[model samples]
Target: MGRPCALREKEVERVFSTPTIQQINSDYAEFFNLVGNNTGVDLSENGFRDITTVVDFLYIQVSYRIYYPPLPDWTTEGNVKCNNNPIIPCKDKTVYEIMKEMNDLRFYVMYNSTELHKLDGGSVLTDIGKKFGEYVAGNRSVTYNIYSAHDSTVSAVLTALQISDAKQPEYTATVMVELHKSAGDAQGHEVKVFYKPITDNSSIEEKNLPGCPSPCKLEDFLQYVKRFEISDWDKECGNNVPTTPAPPSTDSLGLTHQEKITIIACSTVVVVFCLILLIMFVRKRSSRSMAPYLSLGTGA
Candidate 1:
């Protein structure tokens, strides 16, 4: 299943919860009504009343028969069929638009603020910049640096660069940062950003960071992205709880084997002395009772 809405902001969490199936039906009643009219199936009155069922339905709409071995002849959004009829006949555009909204909302929740952008994408961009700087300085040999990341990373980087189209990143979405230099150019090396969406026919698309040229100069790109760079991630993310010092090791308690033996011997001696005193007290009381009995016998 796709990730649930990323309600990261306190206000967003406070204001929203998972929408019930009934709520979804109510909110998107018009879209559902159109689907029902076109397909002769009232989703609201059917098993779609449960949210899990609706989510499964949406999943089926987007990903149909793409996973199993011996994949279908063709698997695309166009192949989404209801009763063996193409979904396009049932207002597929509306369905897709709703899906897009779901993705846009999720992106907004995780990458809305500048700080969030830094926490999610700033460090990554910083590392790329530093590595590229190393390569330019002739200190690095590796040419390709690959990072496998989640959709949130893609969304965050796009948002940080102010180039996000506000669409939900599809599965296997990728963002690439490349360094380039023109032959003996006065401007020296430059940086370029490219993104590839998850669509079957999707190709890498060049993206320009806001206020920067298409092929942004390395120096200017570094300067622009510096605002998002973070030196201390823990401090920046407010994860600054003082660490609890580890407990002292038991072996470091400074007790020698001989000292331990001496202490145990002293404790045993004290216990034995107290036992002897208790025995004497008990014998004295017994003797006193016996003497009184002997005196009564003599009197008798």
Candidate 2:
């Protein structure tokens, strides 16, 4: 597997919590809406008041499919066929079609929510591409840069790389990045990048970096990857902004009760500080004047 490339925490993972059923429903409802906006799935079906209702219905439908395990392309989303279901009359709502909506909903949730780049609507790609460049440049000395992360991490990285063609990654699915250097001819040396989806098969020829021919040259790949590297990542990220608070509100001349109290307290401190400073300034001036007279031998 390629090194786990993580720059920002997945926003979905942060927002998706399992604290309570209400919280889960609320989160899922928002997620469904976001997905619906993209997929144009009519989530308001069958007496559904809100997106939460659709989510609840989906859960129930999924549960029913799991329990009965419907028959002959009639039961589940992936296997179900609308026309030739021998067991039940569900041409209108054959399994996969309904499931595909849910699937599409889920896909759009991950697809839209994730950040693209810290530089420009992107973040993970910036880091991942830089890391790939580093690896290709023979800079990293570590054995394994591990990514003990969620499915969102995998999805986010893929989306950032502009590579996510398939559905979300399965559990423990590894995306291997193979950077190979060839010594076919004495005239020139070449390097290519290959990405393999999580699979048991040994063959990785199908997952070639698109547009670039297989066994692509090193210089060419470097030039291609350089686009993802931002000129100033820190500036682009806005990381150096100080945490200094906004100045107190000055909307009204007459202060409210709380504001009155705050202003009074502040005025007291300001007066005290100014008085102390004035006293010091006067004493310093007096001392300077006194010094000249004292130098005249205490007025003879």
Candidate 3:
């Protein structure tokens, strides 16, 4: 973790140096530059180390307001006035207006500027599609499946689904998929999607998936999501996994059958020759010992 950035520059460059992010970063810097020019005070004086600092601060406010409404409001903590600061762009704007603008900007930065949702959101879409498939086949017994995911997850899914009004999902926002079976003359299954915003828990907004009917048929829904479904995530993300080679087979030990037979014959011949030499040595020892015994008997 303490490694130098220079060493891992190539690995992380794609994230920071993408053309879309670069353009957004440029725009971000220009906004800060205008603020600095008019205020006669460097906003960077307050630990604004990078161009993303101001945008990140605004996002933090938005996030806190939605995610933790019970918490004390940080924006009004220091008697801060919207109109007193000429550098502040959202002068005389309500908190809701500020959040809305930031949310829109966040959505643009995350999805609108690039085709990243196709890559990042593919897995979530695939899982949802599989669930629909399972529900139709009666394979899934559980009725409700919940995914505790980040806002990016919601945005990516919406973008991948080609929802025309796709924007950044607020904190505690939910995306639900409902599978309904026709009761009467209608014999086909239908899929319905609903999004519940954090602002109103009681209200669930029904969305019309682009290129599909309001109550999309199970078959059409599956086909529509097929484009965004990811089968091999690692391959799609360009993650290369090392593979081990299989062991060689015993039948073919890199030698011809004739060569193996010749080896066996040579080994047999060597074993038989060693056995013959051992027998001859044993006989020679026996003959010498018998001669000594006969000489002793003759001398007696």
lDDT per prediction? Answer: 0.62, 0.48, 0.59
Could you tell which candidate, 2 or 3, scores higher by TM-score? 3
The ten-residue window of minimal lDDT in model 3 covers 1-10
Candidate 3 wrong stretches, greater than 4 Å: 1-30, 33-103, 112-115, 164-166, 183-186, 199-201, 248-300
Please report the candidate that would top TM-score against the real structure. 3
- Give the per-residue Cα lDDT of candidate 3 at 247: 60
Q: What lDDT does model 3 reach?
A: 0.59
- Lowest lDDT 10-residue stretch of candidate 2: 44-53
Relative to the unseen true structure, what is the Cα RMSD of model 1? 10.6
Q: By lDDT, is 1 or 2 better?
A: 1
TM-score of each: 0.56, 0.42, 0.57
Per residue, candidate 1 scores C-alpha lDDT tens digits across 1-300 of 022223234333432333443344455555555555544555554222322223334554455544545322221233222232221132443454443444454564456566666666666787888888889889777999998887668787788788888765776888888899945696599888888886677588999888887788888998987887766555554554579988544446687667778899999999999999999999999998887443444553
What residue pairs are clashing in model 1? none
